[model samples]
Target chain A: MNIRIENLTKSYGDQKAVDSISFEVKTGEVLGFLGPNGAGKSTTMKMITHYLNIDAGNITIDGRSVRNTDMKKHIGYLPEHNPLYEDMPVIDYLRFVAELQGVDAVKLDDRVKDMVRLCGLNDEKHKKINELSKGYRQRVGLAQAMIHDPEILILDEPTTGLDPNQIVEIRELIRTLGNSKTVILSTHILPEVEATCDRILIINKGKIVADGTAETLRKTASGSQVLRVKIQAPSQDEVKESVSQLAGVALVEKVEGSENRLEIQSHVDQNVNEAIFRLCVDKNWVLTEMVPFETKLEDIFRDLTMN
Target chain B: MKTSNATWIIAKRELSAFFNSLVAYILLISFLGFTGFFTWLSGNGDVFFRKQADLKVFFMIANWTLFFFIPAVTMRLLAEEKRSGTIELLLTKNVSDRQMVLGKYLSAFLMVLIALAFTIPYYLSVSQLGNFDHGATLSGYLGLILLSSAYIGIGLFASSLTNNQIVAFLLALLLGICFQFIFGVLANGSTGWISELFNTLSLTSHFDSISRGVIDSKDVVYFLSITFLGIFLSEYIISKRK
Candidate 1:
C-alpha cells in the first residue's frame, strides 16, 4: 500500500501541532521519519492509521481517502509509549491483536507462532507482559504490529528499549519486511535510519526540512570537499604554502598538534586530488596519506534542524 | 470485520480480564451474599417475616446494591485504558468507537446478569415455601436487568469522561443518584407539571411499576432510552479525537 498525505494539519487549541505537512510513501519503500520531540512525526502517523482526526487535509491510502474509508486492517501501527495490557501473556496479546486485525481463526495459531519466532519471543511467550523486561516488551510490541501481515507498518521508536544485539536483529527483520511492505518509522537514532531506511525525511517544528537519501543529504549539506593529508616534506610551512597555492584549493592549514598533517578544503564542485598529487611530485614532498572526508549525517541533521 | 463480531471480541477480552483478576469473584460472592442475606436470612425483610412468596424484598435490596456495584464493575472499563494509553492501541484497530463502547457496555451488563442468575435459588425456595406469583417474580428480575442496563450506560459514560477510575466511579454514582432517588424526592415535594416530569424521569417509578407485574412499554422505553443515550455520548466523546 502507498500513503499520500497532502497539507495535513492538526492543532491543540491555539497551537498548531502539525502545520500543513505533505509527503508520500510508496510501496516497498522504507521512510525514516526524523524529527525532534513535538515535531509531528507521531501525529502524522496517527492520522494515517486513522487514530486521529485530520483537522484540515487529506490522507489517502492506495488512492482512497482515509477519512471516508477504513484503512486500519492494511496498516499496522506501534504507537508511541507502546501501551499494552500488562496482565496479558505475550502469546495471548499477540493473538488478541491478530483477531482484532481480522486474521482468520484457522490461521490464528500459525500467525502467533510465526510472530513469536520472528520476534525471538519463544522463551517468554507465556509470561505476562508486565513480567518482561523493557526490551522484551518492545519486541512484543513489534510482534503484535506485524502479526496480521499488514502492507504498511508505522512504528514509533521501534527499537527504543532493545539491546545492541536485539537492535541489529530487529533492523534485519525490518529490512527483510521492507522488501515487500511500506514502512514509516520515526526515531531519534540517526544511523538506524541509514541502516534501515531507503529514504530519510527530516522534519522540524511540524514542517519538512529535508527529504532525500543519505548521500544526497550529505552532498547538499556541505558542497565543499575536505581532505586530510599527511606529508613528509623539508618544511611543514613550505608544504602548507605549496598546497594552498594549488588551483581549486580554497584553504590549507596544519592540523593542530600535528607536525606533517594538513587539512585542505576544496571549492564547491572542485576536485583537488590530482592537483595536490602533481604538486607533491613537482615539489619533492612525498604525500603519505590523502583521505576524503564526507560530511556526517549527524552534522547534516543538526545543520537542518537547528536554528 | 462485522460490527457485532468486533464488539464480541472486545467484550470477550474484557470479560476474561475481569475473571483473570479478583474483581469477578469478589463481585459475585458479595452480590450473592448481600442479596441472599436480605432475601432469606435477615430478621426484618426475611421471606418468613414478610409472609410473602414473591421476591419483592430481594428485588428491593438488589436494586440498591446494584446501584453501587455496577459503577465498580464499570469503573476500569474505559478509565484504566485511557490512563495506561492503551486506548490509542485499541481504537486504532478495525473496531469503531460505537462498537468499543457497546462491547464494554455488554461486558458489564453480562456480569450483572451472571450475578442475578445466582439468585434463582431464592426464587425456587421461596416458591416451595408458599404460593408464588411467577409473573411478578419474573417481572422483578426483568426490572433489575433493565435498571442495571441503565446504570452501566451511565457508568461507561462517566468512564469516558476521565482517565481516573475513582472519578469515573464517583461520577457514575453522582449521575445515578439523580435517577435513583433525587428525582423521586424532588417529585414528592412538587405538585405541578414539574413534579409530573420528575416523576416520569425518575428510575424508581419505572422500576416499581415493572416489578409490580406490569410490563408497561413506557418503563421499558425509559430504561432503553437511557442506555442508548449513554452509549451515544460515549461514542461521541471518543470519536471527537478525530
Candidate 2:
C-alpha cells in the first residue's frame, strides 16, 4: 500500500550514486521524484524495486521488506529506458510479462486486454514491436508494467523520450493511474511534477533535500518576488529610486527602455505594491502595467538544485 | 506461478521469431541441403549405408551444418533485447533471471527440433530403399537433440553477455565449436587428470557414442553439463546487467 525507505544508500566505489535518502509514498498517492540529471532518481527507483542492492539501509513496501518475493508480487516498475523485446508483437510481449507475474491462463487475455485499452495501444496490439513509433513503444512499456495490476508502480523518467503531445497524454494516464495505485515517479520536468504529483521530493547530489507540496515549496524557495512595472513617463529613474526606498523593496533596477519600466525585487515579510503605487501616483508617473511574477516550479527547482 | 509457464511464454515468442524470421528458414534449408548431400555422397560407399540408411553420416553432417546456422539463430536471443533496451521491461515484469534465460533457450532449442523434424522425409526414403539400423536412427536423432540444445544454451549465454548481436554470434560460435571439438582433441595428447577432464567435456565424443546407437550415462551427463552450464552463465550475465 506504500513504500518506506530508511537511510538508503547505494555507492559505486567512493561515489554515492544514491546517498542516504528516505521518503514514503502512501497508497493511491502520487509522489513526484524531482531532480536534475545524476541526482540518483533512477538509482532510488532501482533500489526500491530490488533491482540494485543497497549499499546500506532498509526499504519496505506496504509493510513488507522489498527483498521478499511476496513484495515483488505487489509491485510494478517501468525502467527509464523503456526496453522491450522489439522482435515480438505487442500483444505477445504483454502476455509474456503477464505470465511472468504469475497471471493465470484464464485471466491473462482479459488482463492484457485491459492494459491495451488503458494505454491506448489497441490499434497496434498485433504489430511487431520493432515497427512502432517512440510514443507507441512507450505505450507498450506502460501496458506491460500495468498488465499485472500491481499495487505499487515505480516509473523512472517515463516521459523522457516522448513528444509534447504524447507527454501530455502520458501525464494524464499517470494521474489516473496514481488515483488507484501508489506511484513513485521520477522526472526532471518541473511542470510535469506540478501537474501530476500530490507531493514533491526534490533530490540534490543524491540526497533528498526538500519534500513538500509544489505550491508550498515554491512559496519558500522564491525568497523575493519580482514585479515588472511599466510606467508612461519616458524616464522612470525617479520612480525606481522611490521604489528602492520602500520598506520591503530589496532592490530596484531600471530596465533599459524608453518604455518607462523597472524590475522591482522584494524581500521576505513585506509587500511593496502599496509603496510602489503611492510613489507612481505622487510622481504622476502613469502606471501602464503592473505584473507580479507568480511563483514557478522551475524557479523553485533551480533554486534548490542548481546551487 | 510455475516456472514452466514463464518458460512457455518466452518460448512461444522465441519460436515464432524463429519461424517468422528468414534466418531460421535459411538455416533450416542449408542444414537439410548439407546433410542431404553428405548422405548421398556416402551412399553405397560407407559400410553402414551398403545395407541401411546412413543416419550416422546424416547426424555427423548435422554437426557441421548447425555450426553455421545455430549460432545465427541463437545470437539475438538475449543480445538483441539488451541492444534495443527491452531487457529492463522484461526483468521488472516479475520474471526471474532463470525464467528469462530458460524461456529464450527453450524457444531457440525448439527451433532445432522442428528443423530436425523436417528431415523425417529422408528417413522415410532410406527405409523404403533398404533395411536401416532403426535403433541407431532414433538415437541419432536423440543425440542431435541434446547436442543442438547444448549449442543453443551456449549461444544464449553468449547472447546475454553483450548487447551486440554480432558479438554474441561470434562468441556463441567460438564456444560452441570449442565444446564440440577442442576437448576431444585435447584429451588425445594428455594422460592424467587434465586428460580425464577434457574427455569428460568432449561433446563430439558423447554425441559420437549416441551416433553409434548407444546411450551412455557419462555421455548424457556430458551433454547435460554443457546445456546447464550455458544456461547458468546466461542467468549470471543477465542478473548483473540489472
Best by TM-score: 1
Model 1, A64-98: lDDT tens per residue?
98886367888888999999999999998999989
CAPRI-style class, candidate 2: medium
Task: Give the residue spans of candidate 2 off by over 4 A.
Answer: A231-235, A279-288, B41-49
Predicted structure with the largest DockQ when compared to the true one: 1
lDDT of 2 by residue, A1-307 (tens): 8889999998887998888898888988999999888999898888787777667888997677887745677878888878877778999888878877888889999999999998889899999998999889888888877878888888887887789998999999889989999999988788899899999999988999889998789777876778888877646566666778889989887777545778888998678888888877888878878899778888778888886
TM-score of each: 0.97, 0.91
Query: In candidate 2, what are the lDDT values of residues B22-139, reduced to their tens digit?
Result: 7777888888888887776655544245555556677888887887778898899898888776666666556677888888888888888888998898888787776677888888
Candidate 2 colliding pairs: A83-B85, A83-B86, A84-B86
> What 10-residue stretch in candidate 2 chain A is worst by lDDT?
A233-242
> How far does residue B143 in candidate 1 sit from its true spot (Å)?
0.3
Candidate 1 deviant stretches above 4 angstroms:
A257-259
